[model samples]
Target chain A: MKITIQVMVPPYSYEDLDTAIKIAEAALDKGHEVTIFLFSDSVLAVNKLVKPVKADRNIPEKLSQLIKEKGLRVEICGICMDYRGVNTDMIIEGSNPSGLPELAELIYTSDRFINLMA
Target chain B: MEKKVLFVAYQSPVGSVWPNEVFRTAFGMYGEDIEPAVLFLDEACVTVSKNTKPELLGLFPLTTCHRLIKRYGTPVYVVKEDLERYNVKEMEEIFNPQILSRVELSDFLHQFDLVIFM
Candidate 1:
């Protein structure tokens, strides 16, 4: 089954990003296709430069590893990245920059589309 | 077949984008044979109050909320105690919601096949 997860909140503010990662990990482990679209403040979750000073888990590395090892398709919203001043140079290697239109297309075709927004 | 879907809104309108989008989605959810319901709990009870003016905050107008109930014929529910705590009096002409006590609200929640919280 095709499942698309949209995360629209920053990691520090809440658990939205964490929950999205866990859900995506479980879905991939179960052999289902998982696609994650990060939008709004969530675009920060893929910034390779920003590291959590206190948190044990490195979110960006975890996401990059998910893409590389688990075959998770991660996309960050272009508009959101611009608003957050994130460029391709700062984004994690595996995730691609995308737009809402592509996210909408994914949602239209996916069997389940879950939006986790703040 | 029609499925029972309940949208539980706990965020106050105009405080952020979430409540506004949730209601907008609820408005769009109504059509065909779909059974949709809305439950405003906690701070969200203020959105249905006769006094809220979300437009003044440069957000979705509170009047559009009236249209949501009138156009969709969606049953709107709010916790009576919550409204009391927020000091928002439930006016049927304005809010068009059925007042539900805590226990009644819990039972009402169990009837829905899907319950989405915002």
Candidate 2:
């Protein structure tokens, strides 16, 4: 199954991001294709400049690593990023800019769509 | 074949963005291969009351959503358990929303190809 998740909250603000990652990892482990669509504050999770202490878990870095190692596809909302002043240079290297059309396409194509928000 | 896609709204619509965002996404799927619907479950049934006004909470009026739901023929649903909790047995008949029990809802959910919820 192809699973697409739409995340609307920022990382670390709540358990949404972490839980999304766990679900994606579990799905991937089961040989399912997973893609995450970051919108609203969730676009912040793709920022490469998110630095945390050596002891703390860096959520954005974890997402970036997943994109590299686990083939997790992350697409940040273009308008949401623009509104938040998030440029391509600031986001995870593998993440791409997308729009509502892409989100609709993701919804239409995916076997499962998970929306993580308040 | 039309793909059944459900957007589950679990928050009260007064000032929260989840219900608005969920409905907006479901409505945005105009002229698509997807059949998008919005379900008001959990605390979201607070917005299902006939007299509730989102504008009173400084949010946009839901009349616009009602208009879109009518025009696009999008399905809107509120949970029976939640309605009982809020003592709101009489909801606006704008779309004549389907009221399903928790168990019936679980069974109905299986009919969808995708279910989006936080």
Which is the leading candidate under TM-score? Answer: 2
Error of 1 at B104 (Å): 1.4
**Candidate 1 residue lDDT tens string, A1-118:** 9998988779767888889999999999999999998866889999888767874678898899999999999988886799789999998888999874575466546777787752
Look at candidate 1 and give me any clashing residue pairs. Answer: none
True contacts kept of each: 0.00, 0.40
- Report the C-alpha lDDT of model 2 over A20-54, residue by residue, as the tens digit: 99999888889899999998888998888987788
True contacts kept of 1: 0.00
Candidate 2 deviant stretches above 4 angstroms: A22-33, A68-71, A82-89, A111-118
lDDT of each: 0.77, 0.83
lDDT of 1 at B42: 88
Write one digit per residue (lDDT tens) for candidate 1, span B5-104: 6777788876765555455556655443446678888888887777677788677676666766676676778888998999986454745788899978
Q: Once model 1 is optimally superposed onto the true structure by TM-score, how far is the C-alpha of residue B27 displaced, in angstroms?
A: 3.0
List, for all models, the DockQ compared with the true complex. Answer: 0.09, 0.36
Poorest lDDT segment (10 consecutive residues) of candidate 1 chain A? A100-109
Q: Quality of candidate 2's docking, in CAPRI categories?
A: acceptable
- The TM-score, computed over Cα atoms with residue i paired to residue i, of candidate 2 is 0.80
TM per candidate comes to 0.67, 0.80
